[model samples]
Target: MAHQLPETTSAPTLFTHSHPQGIDPSNPHELSASLYNEDLAPTTRKGRTWNSYSIFTLWANDVHSLGNYAFAIGLFALGMSGWQILAALGIGAILLFALLNLSGFMGEKTGVPFPVMSRIAFGINGAQIPALLRGAVAIAWFGIQTFLASQVLSVMVIALAPGAASLQQTSFLGLDTLGWICFVTLWALQLVIVSYGMEMIRKYEAFAGPVILVTFLALAIWMLFESGFNVSMTTGESRSGLDMWVGIFGAAALWVSIYGTFVLNFCDFTRGASSKKAIVRGNFFGIPLNMLFFGAIVVVLTGTQFSINGAVISSPSDVVEAIPNTLLLVLASGALLILTIAVNLMANFVAPTYALTNLFPKKLNFRTAALISGVIGLVILPWNLYNSPEIINYFLGGLGALLGPLFGIIMADYWIVRRARINVMDLYRTNPEGTYYFTRGVNFRAVAALVISSVVALLLAFVPALHVVGPFAWFLGSGAGAIVYLLMAKRRIDLADIDGEAIAVTPKH
Candidate 1:
């Protein structure tokens, strides 16, 4: 594997390598870097650039989650019509597309993961806070996603044996006996795959992504034909023009917030990208096109279910449960179960591993991070914690507040202030003059903005008077944080004038 060092005297970073002592001379592909050590970097490889289709596959993995399904159906209950929901979906996706483009550029340019990239804006030491925050969030979500995957597993098991359905009646620590077993099983399975590392995750995602697409299309077609194309169900939200716009914005903001955590770290994966061309191509196919197509199928199938069954069905398990033919039901449930697990591992599980590994590189390596997260998730029993949307709303909202400000401050610093230039060596130095170093390995300015903005948004989310903008909690927090940081930092730190040579930039963990 080839490694590119930061530029020297206007030359683009040149590929340079001298092996470290005390390590076996191993193949680049096989060598794993120290958790927090900056010396080990991703190897450059040929033909690793993902094309547009591959990007679409990534979205397929991201969008096919149980949480996504529930979100789609939840739109119907918002009091709008079908068309309004479609509009919201479309508009929201567009916003998300733009956001992905913005955040992804740094990744493509730097070829580093999110945590590493943070060294540019947050300083090497300051970067750890955001890394930990992002990683911690991923950890929580990893557990939640595992719980969701397990639900589908339980559904499949119970479907296979009607007698086993009785397990649902018995409760232990908020989950039933079957729930505990399935949760642990899925938890363990993810641990194994994630333990194998990113390569295995990529391979599993590539295949599972295509399979889920085919399955979803088939299910949509079957529903439309059976329920009739023109069938109508419940009246959705946003019937009026103004209301529709609100819903559209809300929907778009929701998509942005849902992905806000990853948006900060998208560079993590993109840093490994073969080139800037690959990163752009991937985002185009993955974020916009993929989300729209998936959203369309989701709406169609969910709508059909409502029209035919007189109730909205969201979870793929619910969709499978609706199948009349027992054989078909079994097959569909099994497929969905597999799909859920794949997405859970890729989107939810793998990310936290990277995040936690970054936080305690020497002590908690990637494997250790994954293990700790799994244990905590098992203890929380997120399955039981997520019994209702209110719970989901609370959890998601709290995260949204924190992530929004962190994202805002980072983006403002990087693109607007730094103008995209960085000193790779300075990133590692603890000198106060380093571009990222603030005071005490932490950026009090950014942290203060984050805390203040998050509190305001959180209040708006919970207070009745602010319910009108309840769904936009993330947008408010991020937007406010960015604006505040920009104004506050403008005079104190001229982001553009920082001498590129004076500030050494290091690779992220």
Candidate 2:
């Protein structure tokens, strides 16, 4: 088969010779240095080292997060019994498992990350739109997560130097002076870990995941014992029948919403999977099972907090701080800090690294982009963004509405519109002749789909009536985007014309 890349004016990346999946050498399509880099290119077989356990650890790190644990605790405060909350979580976990499998399939089979996988749908140059959007979201969240992790550090510092508690009285940019020191401290720590790249991240995650699981599980057990093994299930008035089902689905949707941003770029990790079965096994154990068990732990801790303290404390830090024993407090604080770093690196760090690198492949490799992102994360003053409702709701929330449509359009183009067929070489090359290089390397059809779907999705955010289904905004928006894209694609890739043979174009593993 002929490599379809254009003749480059300058030298292609070193990836041309080093990686088998790079530009072909003989009768080679030398990928342009402007759009091609080793970091963004498909991984070679030797590079795919993540096993089933690696994948499991990935989610374990993500699920055990302080934010996620807090969200789980809030579910019980809504009058739902323990069983009801568990059912809702189960439904949401399965939905995440299913969506991740769908989003990850293309990357796993192709050994390509999310940004490159997007080239098939968004066109090469036009792919920059989603890349920029994803990069912005990732950077913003990265800063916010770092700010959160810093708070955990604050707890540890005071546990050691009790005098550090005085630092809270003085404030700057919504954080105290010592908070700044701790923020940068944790920031530097995460920067060191992220700088080592994905292989190192995978290894650290394997260790962090199991440790976080043990620590949090132990915290829950201790809390259970402190509360005399008495846990309350109901905090508010109970409802059954259709109302109960509504609550269950609503809670399920909310639980799944926590993953809304992460899922769009999930291919970044799944692309390194050692086997298809590994991803399946990992997703099964990591998502529904892990979510269920972790959520159960959160429920136990929160219920016991209510029993012991006679108050509902949802924040993990608050719950931990309330622990009377200094020894347990120190250990739990350290565990929370580890999980925060694990989740931040896996979720917040990796996406922006790839997205930013994709925009300027010649000037920016993974490390350079990562450094740039980390620096920007510090300068953004993310504490303000987290504290301000107007900015959070309008600015970030508005931009976030696109995540679903971006994901929807990609899924639609890959599965529904194109029916899984793709021209792989075309994804890397910038030539007008390449299959994906539509209309100056931009797909107006996909753009139109995004604008239309985003508008539909945003209605749920603004409209009072639609707010009832706001928990499902991502799901609803994805459906809207997919339907629109499929409709638009009928002219370009006729369903009846390319139904049978098109599947062979993008080679299978």
lDDT of 1 by residue, 180-296 (tens): 888888889877876765556666777888788888888888888988784564444335777667777787677667777767777665654566676667777776677777777
| Candidate lDDT (C-alpha), each | 0.66, 0.79
Model 2 residue 322 lDDT? Answer: 77
Best by lDDT: 2
Error of 1 at 108 (Å): 1.9
lDDT of 2 by residue, 200-284 (tens): 8898899899998898788788888889998877665666899899989998988877788777888888878877888889999
**CA-only RMSD, every prediction:** 5.9, 5.6
For candidate 2, what is the lDDT? 0.79
User: How does residue 490 of candidate 1 score in lDDT?
Assistant: 42
Q: Over the full model, what C-alpha lDDT does candidate 1 score relative to the true structure? A: 0.66
TM-score of every candidate relative to the true structure: 0.84, 0.90
